[model samples]
Target: MHDRTPHAAAAARYPHQSHASGPLVDVSSPEGGPGQHGNTYVQGFGNLADPLAIDGFLRIQEGRVNQFLQVSDRRAEAQRSALQQAADRLSNIANNIGAILKLEHEAIKKQLQEANAKVDEAVKARDELRRLADGVNWTGSAKVSDQEIRSKWKQLEYNIRSLASVLAKCQTKVPSDKLTRTRLDEVSTAWRKLLVVDDYKNFLIGAYI
Candidate 1:
């Protein structure tokens, strides 16, 4: 150990402080501190443990500790800000999804009401046609010609068949193999062949099973 009485005044210059008190100022640096400057050692327990030397070493260590804490605090604050931003983004996304769902629900309800109105119109048309047919007595001399009546009835049958075909297609889900009883109105041969294509198979992935 070496006496530090000479540098006592210099030791008191730093801002950091330490409350440690002991009989040693045993620094780990070599005789010159780990560099090529000069030397610092200890004598017996008295001069080595002088309050000045002890206080100086403690102040230097305190400065290092304070610096590390400052850096750590800055990093912690940055991480907290990042987490808050992520949470806000997720909340906005959730609200947008809810808005979209509400719009879709309203649209579907409107479509249902229109469909009901169309159904009522179709029933009225059928009733009117039945009354007109009853007025033309086939038992006696018919008011309307047989050929004209046959043509009209055939047209009505064709319309009914077309409607049935459309309904069958709408009711069936994609991946039709899942159904135990397969039933669908026939389409053109060329259109039916396209169902086996890879593109069609890929398109079916998004469809309801």
Candidate 2:
């Protein structure tokens, strides 16, 4: 009869096998297989099951994220400062423009006032000249006969010659005396009246001549 125990059965299945004659395979080394290369199984992540390695990677990513956030904040602050500066410049420009406009307005207002004053003065002078002209015309149009005008003209000529002689004598003799001065003023006034009458009679004699 054959032995049927478990160890006798394994010996009967591989009668030529022995522990020392088998090839030794290293499972931990990637070069142990024909298709294996460096880090082929892990895909260069380096031990995905390790907590310390994952934590280090996470900490590096967090550092990068924080650095990016800080850079973004600084850029935003700089932009806000630049915008504020631009706004301040615009405000100053607007104020300067407003001041310029105000000055121009004042200058125009003063010019208008001066123009109005000049216009008023010219109108008053023109009116005064017109009144004087009207008075001369009215005086020339008085209703006097030609005979009367000729007689008045002769009398005025005589008075003018007599007054001129008196004024020449007084100027030579009593030029500074108060009584002589008064008499000279009266004589000058009478001479002016006689001259006015002479001019009127001349206008009347134009038709006769």
Candidate 3:
């Protein structure tokens, strides 16, 4: 007959029984209570009656959990390090870009200054050419002597050559400039006219001599 004691009933009624702990004991039968299998006595609630077995299982679970936590921590640390390295590289790239932009700005400023100087020089050359052209004494009074006319003709020839030279220089400096090209064409036309006038004057002087 099975013991109907409260202690035996409580032990039987305990939860967490499993055949995996060891072979299950048929505690419900009077002939099968507290049966031993090898060195283990697996009772109610699996191996709960054996404190050492329960402790060993808990320790194994604790070790597995700790190992998982360690692996996770290492992975997290590696991720953090990678992120920091990427941030550092980006910062370096940004700094390099800023430096490059600064250098480009300085170079552009220098180029602009050089361009302005060239423009000023070209303008001065154009003004000087205009002044020289205006100073030429092309037509003299009828009272002027032939010798005075010859001297004026010589001076006019020199002045025209100077104008051509100045115009050539201006053209070289601003080859793409439409205004400089137009001025050069005008100067070339005037020089051709002067050549014809020079020939006419020499003929008149030769006849008079």
Candidate 4:
């Protein structure tokens, strides 16, 4: 209980210093930063609030993909149409060729038929000529007598009439096959020679008489 004025004055002046204290926590501790295990941190505060921007981006990407698909489909359709047109053109060409071949075949057949008919008619005419020539029997001798000369002349005249009549029938009929002009000229020359020989023989007989 020995109090003094100096001690009382010291206690009032050092009141805050005597009662205040510091914590015992460590100061040099490792924190979650550059050298720590959790090196990075993320936040949803700026971009997550804007829904319109995200939807617009998605719509743009979808539109680009759909446009590409549409272009591919159009190209494929154009190719198919071109191929179909080519096929149809080929079919038409084939059909036209077949029709032309058929017509050509028919024309050739008709020509052959006409040629055969001509051959048959020519054969019949030749047979008739052969029959006529075979039936005639000239019995006159090669002597200068009035009766023999008259008989030979009459027989020659009859043979000439028969040859003329056969040739007249051939002129009226139409032959389907092609005829050689040279062959007709040769036949005419042969007929003329026969007539000249008969005339000479008759003249000789008349002179002798």
Clashes of each: 6, 0, 0, 0
| Model 4 per-residue lDDT tens digits across residues 79-176 | 99999999999999999999999998887676556545544554555455454456434566333456654555565444444434333322222224
Candidate number with greatest TM-score: 1
Q: lDDT winner among the candidates?
A: 2
lDDT per residue, candidate 2, 17-136, as tens digits?
A: 553434544344554544345446665566777788889999999999999999999999999999999999999999999999999888767655654554455455545544544544
> Which order, best to worst by TM-score?
1, 3, 2, 4
CA deviation > 4 Å runs, candidate 2:
1-47, 50-56, 135-209
Pick the winner on lDDT between candidates 3 and 4.
3
lDDT of 1 by residue, 121-179 (tens): 54555565686687556577647766866766665554444443333333333344523
lDDT, candidate 4, residue 17? Answer: 45
In order, candidate lDDTs are 0.55, 0.57, 0.57, 0.54
Residue pair clashes in candidate 1: 1-41, 1-42, 1-43, 2-41, 2-42, 2-43
Q: Rank the candidates by lDDT, best first.
A: 2, 3, 1, 4
Better of 2 and 4 by lDDT: 2
